[model samples]
Target: MSSPTSVLLAGGGSAGHVSPLLALADTLTRRHPDLVVTALGTEEGLEARLIPARGFGLRFVPKVPLPRRPSADLLKLPGRLKAAVDAAGAAIDETGAEVVVGFGGYVSTPAYLAARRRRVPIVIHEQNARPGLANRVGARFTTFVATTFSTTDLPHARRIGMPLRREIATLDRSALRDEALAHFGLATEWPTVLVTGGSLGAKRLNDAFASTVAALSRGGVQVLHVTGQGKTFVPDVPAVGAPYVVVEYADRMELAYAAADLVVARSGANTVCELTTVGLPAVYVPLPIGNGEQRLNAADVVAAGGGLLVDDDALTPHWVETELIPLATDGDRLAVMARASAALGEPAADEQLADLVELAWGTRA
Candidate 1:
């Protein structure tokens, strides 16, 4: 029998980077049973826990955060980065990695540099519309780049969509609608809207939705609000008349997506990809900070007639009452939006990314 093809995947810190890495790793292993897949991350990153729990080998490198401004940390950056690169080089050698796949994060930078030094092929995947700093640096190491959005400008980038878990990629909302409603204790009769602001929760989303719960309930709409973990701003609105359910966090997002006819949330890359993939229309309130990447994330879906984009500052109770209520109540319009969303979704992204990695591996051999 031929020896196993060894591969190293790098990314970490946030779920944005880690989730896709896991998805691709899952795909690679399933396709080639003998594939030896290992991941590189920082000790402080979510990958430390998530990677091992998924049954993959993981190695950690020192976190070398790039400083945006001159500071004491910036002075230490050169040495820190060199140390990280050396650690990653040791990992590459130990794993006998022939190719390295990178999802942008602190780990990716060192992984890319080490791979280049070792003459190992590098493949990059960028999840956001605007490339992050790590991916930008990593891109120079190789021409193989995959992106979730077509508009993402990276060297030799192909729009491969976001790598999603099996549960989400194959979810049939209609088939599981009843079970989903039961899971959330929601009524099948009322149109349900799922509101979320990711795991950390958006204070603006929470406040705006809280103020408008009564109005939404009055309009015969039900709500499933995920307030994120540790967020404490409870809405003053009475739930006696409204069918409103608020949870601190949702562990089974598949159920929430299955139950929801509409979603009200921020336009993070993963959230937008999952929503569109499931054919769920949304009211995207882009986070009002950063490089305005959130707005760019939602732009294509909204333009394709799959959803609506409301400015963070413009999202108010009155906006929900006037705009969202009518849209949610119109079943015909919702169906149209759902169709548009499904058309834009690339459900085979995991497989496609695995193909890219395989291609890179072949090139190196």
Candidate 2:
């Protein structure tokens, strides 16, 4: 019945899974210094670097990708799954874990299997409106399932919103606006828009915005474009009416959020949550690939009038000029959208999740 002395977290391979794992780890350790938080991930996962950087221990398992359709990989999956589950079981044993919490991903299936085999209580957090396969499987047996979107279809689901890092969670955009503008080397006077396509960048967003730099500058709109690592390109037309800034990555995303009057980006779970968390109006461009979950991620915000969703094929240079530019310049409409965005933000998800983990641990107690 006592609090868990040590906990094992499972999920990785992408920011979608790793970000929330890091957030929850931080919350747990902050609340209980004696609680040990170790992550179970693969060597290829972003967690390899991120988890250790956050001062948490990490264990590795083989990455087992569940093939969507029949293939050679699918045939080999049974063996790979057993190996990963064995590794996950060893990780739990080595840590003497009292409970296991999982954010669904490739690594999650093994963790779920291992934890179940060990009789370790399981907690699940699904970050998408469209549940991923890993989470769907874990949800069947875990009574402690939490979700970001209320519409997320998972058994035993409870809506806890997306967990955000401390920096983004505590950011005061208006208060930090001046410093953010200076940090990004943009004029404080111009209306600003932030365009991003995650760490690897998006060709669609890159192409569409690159073509419209001059048009945006002429309209006195400053642009902060995070073009992802290695996708950086010099704008052919330099800053004239306002600064047209571009960078390979935004190491300090809080500053980017602080400086923006508007955002144009993909509608991944993280992006959607961050925009709503800070009350920033956005033009969400769902990625063309995947299970069409990106479109589902932004549905509530778009319906709430906090953001706009544009099909990937339709977000072009012409559309930016005709639609986005006008919306960027509309101060009255931006204020309304900002209010709606703030209304939908759940700043306390991290704390709320900590409470649920407490409840789940009690089941073992």
Candidate 3:
């Protein structure tokens, strides 16, 4: 029998990068059970825990963060990065990997350089509408690039969508709606709005949504709010007899997506992809900081009539009461937005990305 094709996947730091890498890894292994898949990440990155837990072999490399400004750290960057590249090259040699797929993070930069030095074919996947610094550097070494958004500016970028977990990619909201409502203890017939600020929570999202809970409840909209772990903000308004469910975290996001008619959240690339994939209309409040990638992530969905993008400063209690309440109550508008969102979703991204990796591998051989 022919030996299994060996592949090394590199990405880490945040769940945004790690999740898609896992999704792709899962896809490749499922399709070809004999495939040898390995992951490279930094000790500090979330991948250290997540990758192994998913039953894949993982190797660690040093995290060499790019210094944005001229400073003391910048002076030592060359040596630091060189050490990382050497470590990554060693992993490549040991695995005998034919192709290296990168999902942009601290690990990816070194992985790309090391793979280039070893003459291994490289494939890159960018999760955001705007490419990160690591992907930008890595793009120069490889012609094979895939992106979640069509507008992402990267070398030879092809729109392959975000690789989502099996649970999310195949979720049927209608079939699970009743079970989802029960899971959250929400009213079965009431229109619901789900609010989330990711796992660590967004203070701005928390404060705005908390202040407007009463108003939303008064509009006959039930709420399932997932406040990030240990984060809380109470509304000043006196409690009305409205359904307002609050939780520290949601372990089953599929149920959360199923139970909601409207969603209010940050527009991280992963969140945007999942929401659109599930056909959920959302009011995206981009984080006011960062390189404006959050805003860019939500732009296409908003432009495509799938959702609304509200600036962080503009998402006040008053705005929620006037704008959000009206939109949530309008069934006709919500249906239209849901359809638009589904139209933009690529549920087959995992398969598509695996195909891209194979194409790159073939080119190398």
Candidate 4:
């Protein structure tokens, strides 16, 4: 009985789903250098590019999302499933993958099915407070299910906080003020706000921020706004003073997190988890869609006094000025929220996921 030398990880579409898989893959490779990690996903997915770029082989499958309306995509589901299984079957045969790990997305469906058909063990890492459609369905077949949220419907799902990159988990807040300011080339003296819409960026969040950008700067705050590439935010009041760092994207999010006294972002599981891991006080505006999963993700922290939740509809300059601005400058309150947020961190998430992966692989060694 040797340790499983190979694994098939399935994920894609959004960075939220793919990032956890990337973290797990990095950890697994470190723990077992000989491990062969293969990804099964559509060529259009972020994984299609990222997996191969990370030196893992990927088997592209023919799978598309089920449309909200009964479209041609839904009509083609049977054929797509067949093609996915065929592709995954070939990849598994080629790589001798002992387990298929599902990270929860459309791409994960076929891999889960393929693994079930091949009688390989299955493990699932569900990153949302509310399980996505794919993970909810995939959970029935999973021998082990890990989740960031304590509350989920999956019978076997265990509470394990989201896995973050090592850098984020070990971020140095002692240099946070100076380092983050320097990283973004902003003033160290002003209260800095880090605004993001999750990995994809949030247009609503950006719009709200833009409306108050000048007012915020006039009130002695510095802004580090990550507007997703190709998105627009119309500033209701023009930036009159030295411009805030208005970038489309920041490649170094760790730096962004490090620099900010407070964060205003979507309450995606990954965003919330990272905020908890790094111990940043935040104003979370959960995306008000899809059964309100994002709201659930931020609710625990908000209830615990670790963060604040704002509905997109309620997001306005008045609210930002009244609530968020004061919180940013209150050092004692920030520390309290930071400590409370840090209390939610699960740094061993990657290792825990690896343990599950090993169990799924059926390797005693």
Name the best candidate (by lDDT): 2
- Tens digit per residue, CA lDDT, model 3, 35-77: 8899999888899899999999999999998888999999999
Instruction: Sort by lDDT, best first.
Output: 2, 3, 1, 4
How does each model score on TM-score? 0.96, 0.97, 0.96, 0.92
Q: What value does the lDDT take at residue 198 in candidate 3?
A: 90
* Candidate numbers sorted by TM-score from highest down: 2, 3, 1, 4
Give the lDDT of residue 43 in candidate 3. 88
State candidate 1's TM-score: 0.96
* Pairs in clash, predicted candidate 4: 197-202
> Candidate 4, 291: how far from true, in Å?
2.2
Candidate 2, residues 114-206, lDDT tens digits: the string is: 999888889999999999888999998788999999799999899989999989988899999999999999898888999999999999999
The clash count for each model shown is 0, 1, 0, 1
Off by over 4 Å in 4: 67-75, 232-243, 363-365
In candidate 2, stretches whose alpha carbon ends up further than 4 angstroms from where it belongs are: none
Residue pair clashes in candidate 2 = 1-365
Backbone-clash count (model 2):
1
Instruction: Report the candidate with higher lDDT, 1 versus 4.
Output: 1
Cα lDDT for residue 192, candidate 1: 91
Q: What residue pairs clash in candidate 3, if any at all?
A: none
